[model samples]
Target chain A: MEIEKPYLLFLGDAPDALAAKTAQGIVDWRRDWCVGQLRLPGCLADTGLPDLDIATARARGGKTLIVGVANAGGVLPPHWAAPIVAAIAAGMDVAAGLHMKLADNPEIAAAAAKHGRRLFDVRHSTERFATGKGVKRPGKRLLTVGTDCSVGKKYTALALERAMTARGYHADFRATGQTGVFISGRGVSVDAVVADFISGAAEWLTPANDPDHWDVVEGQGSLFHPSFAGVTLGLLHGAQPDAFVVCHEPTRTRMRGVEHRLPTIREVIDLTVQCGRLTNPDIRCVGIAVNTERLSDEEARRVIAETVRAEGLPATDPVRFGVEAIVDKIAEEFGLP
Target chain B: MEIEKPYLLFLGDAPDALAAKTAQGIVDWRRDWCVGQLRLPGCLADTGLPDLDIATARARGGKTLIVGVANAGGVLPPHWAAPIVAAIAAGMDVAAGLHMKLADNPEIAAAAAKHGRRLFDVRHSTERFATGKGVKRPGKRLLTVGTDCSVGKKYTALALERAMTARGYHADFRATGQTGVFISGRGVSVDAVVADFISGAAEWLTPANDPDHWDVVEGQGSLFHPSFAGVTLGLLHGAQPDAFVVCHEPTRTRMRGVEHRLPTIREVIDLTVQCGRLTNPDIRCVGIAVNTERLSDEEARRVIAETVRAEGLPATDPVRFGVEAIVDKIAEEFGLP
Candidate 1:
């Protein structure tokens, strides 16, 4: 689903900053794409954009109202309907990352229909995708894989996109999750698609491009995470990445939300190459992205150094350190100038 | 979705038996659950059941009309709608494995609503499932893993279920595909569910049971298959089978609908165990099931014997021979008497 640009992020009655993490993510990465923030009275969360009403945001060239907050049950609160309908009435499209669709609200649906405005439900895929063909497609691709869920896969990819583009390489960040979709403005929420179409959706998201161009594709759940490894494998196959960066959280003892222990980075690389060879024969690990937020500066450096020595690849905390080293490794490995 | 018993198989103007293979599968597996066949004019397919009109089938105590034939383009022909409506009017729920939902047809929806009848769209899941938790549940489970798609996974599981039951062990065949669902009378079409819930749906299908009772789960796709490995992986994590059988087709040249070549039986066993260990660390291969339809009787026996020697597991053609050897292996391995 392709959402319009210059969004007015709707932070509806969010109780804390964590509740509006999606909005915060957009603000963190693509602050220029956001026109303003629209929050209800009880909302305690903030994206720190200029607060504006629907009319003001629309006048400022906001083409979409992004409902980027998570309600307690992922539901659309009854009171938030008015502002969403008002945005639609004002000729702006609406997009949401909620479990519930925006069009499910009667007021929002009617307003969109009357105004000929679109409602993008990013969590629900409206695209009908054919099954993945697994045929080799043109273009270079790099995917970010994780040791576990929420282990900086998206951040690593987005950072790579920025770094590679700055270094005169043609690159685009391809998204596979809701926040990533809103940031990229066009992507399929791969997990939300039917089980049969996981890889198919990923294939569609990263179609054949120029031979030298790179699709820095965002990844999802770890291959060892039982809850979501299917999504991770499908994305891995569909992306057919020539190079991948393994994202890891060193402090985590167990996989997120499960009893299974996190797999070692070596294990992740071995299995990824084994399975990824189906679509791309030359799939290889290029670097490591460590999420060392919980570690001190000395510990982070020690971990990164140890990872580099052990894996024999560039390693860095994408948030704490820039992705320039990894970009340099990609250039050297792929013979890019 | 749980379909009612005594189905009236609807073969709507199918030009050949291949088009009505699903109906034929139900007939072959569960003849007692079906009342009779309902064929439209010009139908060339037959399950060798008594021909019956809608009224006659309903009179014979058919509770559901199974639209078990695939029409051209997976669309319901306009001509067949009248009979479907008539069947609903006669107090029978309708279940179909078509790509298009039954309720999408206005006439069928109206008829079902008017008669308080239900519509079962097997290709479209209406069941909400949580993400798989990967927690071990109590039961003895055996899953069929395939070297490729359409390699007799379902048949192997069903055969094992029958054999184990006749040997005085409590066993149930858990369906994961369309035809298996019809034959078993209940199961979520795991591939049709949202990608995030593939394992979750499988867990629900084979829930906690008696320690010795076996849930013989039907498998889909293969770990080596490019288009469907995600579903296969999710099923592996979710089913957490204590023992598995590798199903192979002896004469296949490549993986189904893809350019990649098939993996060896050893590769399938190794990978299924490697990935399946996330949920069930005790996962092991008990046997091998080969589809020997294209082979001569002597060739089939030779291939089976070779497979037994190579893999050190019980091997047989479930269709040509029987699953008795596999059942014996399972009984011995699990101390099931």
Candidate 2:
């Protein structure tokens, strides 16, 4: 079967010069190959795209894909997802460099499924590839920590990263969400798809020096934050990090009330593992990070560790507990040691 | 205008038997005084009532009000705000027992305008009333401390309350939003509406006392938290707290990106004051409560005091400066001394 060219769709405030340059680059790069590339030029309509140009693009090749580069800031609007999905179903690889997740839009997900094209969230992808180091082999074991927005996941991850570096391990902090550069430090740059590719490439990367100098990539947000979640899932699928670290905090009242009913950490962890399995089936048992405020450090660690362990998984204290100890436990559990 | 029965809207899951019984008691008591009180039957949508058998009941005409009582566990869909506003505008004085605030839903402000009724979030109305008793005296001064959720607002308020009580004046902790029940052995509740009514009733209830009792209310969540912000605003409007103790950390990163965008403490203070004016026009300058997390006691106090005074307002360290110092400064400002 002669593969059709990739279809790219651009959304958001009018494309900037950089985006145009990137698009032209991709088109030119594909010109030398047998791959055909086309761009869809129109805003998504309320009833979905009914334009004839889109149809022509689909007819030219069964590989109709929509690539959208939007700077709308947050998540892609649900309405925009429908047209992209339609374009994808017409046989195209749909790629969006939206700083947000499109998975939040069911229509987009459904459309992606119909088109057999994966929905790649660009935020995590951009973060993974921020330093443009591309994918490199790990010199040691790598672990990534992630959480939902406002959940104190980054602080926990940073604390872990600091802990690992203190142990004389060559550690690097890789941020995977809408996290700007200053927060995550300079590291490799990989888009969502590319991060997954790099994760697969990790198997062939450089061998670990101390077997612990591996990297610690921080997942940006929860499985619910549009872009962050998808990238986390993709990385988990591709890289199969030694262990997943979950950070969570109880809502204010501590008492789960009617409207403010809080989801238990166990439920959240279970859901996380389940979601990760969709992308990668080899996720090991989860570890939990509890933001300690109001509770004393000792008490917070003990309580969270006990709760997580009771949920039938190994849990470690992200605060008082050293990262080396945590990694060791995870290594033992995953047979990495 | 012929007066009509008043109603109360209860939003929540099925009210507990105790709550339902308490509600019925209020209705029965009001009935004896010819104040016809009715509860929204079953769900909120059941707006129709069995033809008011008014022939058998004596007329107690004041206003026709709608009261809704809902279980705390029920999900009050966002759309419910529209009907709630409509019920309030249709000359129905809607009084809800559960906590409701504009901060909880930014859309509430717009929806309230659509129905020509302003949203009066009373999440802490009950708690405010319970604590106002301690400060209920003619010419008695009241003060409040607030912050976004989890910023140590409760501790600041409690500490201030203790400081006032230790000074031979009646001082109590008033609940504004997230705070509830026995703190430092004082009965604290987070009810703003009830506090306002209690404040009004206290003046008439106790004429012999100096009315120098101070009520300290604690606010929850950041300025953006939907429930806490509205509760803070409502309490300020109703109680007209004599002064505000702004609890904050000394670190620059504490402001997140707000410091760069909003830029100076004066701008932040002015923005707070402007928002407060939406609920009350009489708020005086605010003081500062520095969280002593990473700072030494003296350093924290000095920085907080300097920051507060820099805004041209009185500032005191809750840890080093003591509540007495704060009260003394505020009293002097109000010419109480």
Candidate that would win on DockQ: 1
How well does each candidate superpose onto the true structure, as a TM-score? 0.98, 0.31
Model 2's alpha-carbon lDDT is 0.43
User: What is the lDDT, from 0 to 100, of the residue B270 in candidate 2?
Assistant: 58
Q: Write the per-residue lDDT of candidate 1 for residues B261-297, one digit (tens) a residue.
A: 9999999999999999999999999999999999999
List DockQ for all candidates.
Answer: 0.85, 0.01
How big is the positional error of residue A69 in model 2, measured in Å on the Cα after superposition? 2.8
- Among residues 3 or more apart in sequence or in different chains, the pairs in candidate 1 whose N, CA or C atoms overlap within 3 Å are none
Worst 10 contiguous positions by lDDT, candidate 1 chain A: A328-337
For each predicted model, how many residue pairs clash, with residues at least 3 apart or on different chains? Answer: 0, 62
TM-score of chain B of 2: 0.46
Q: Give DockQ: model 2.
A: 0.01
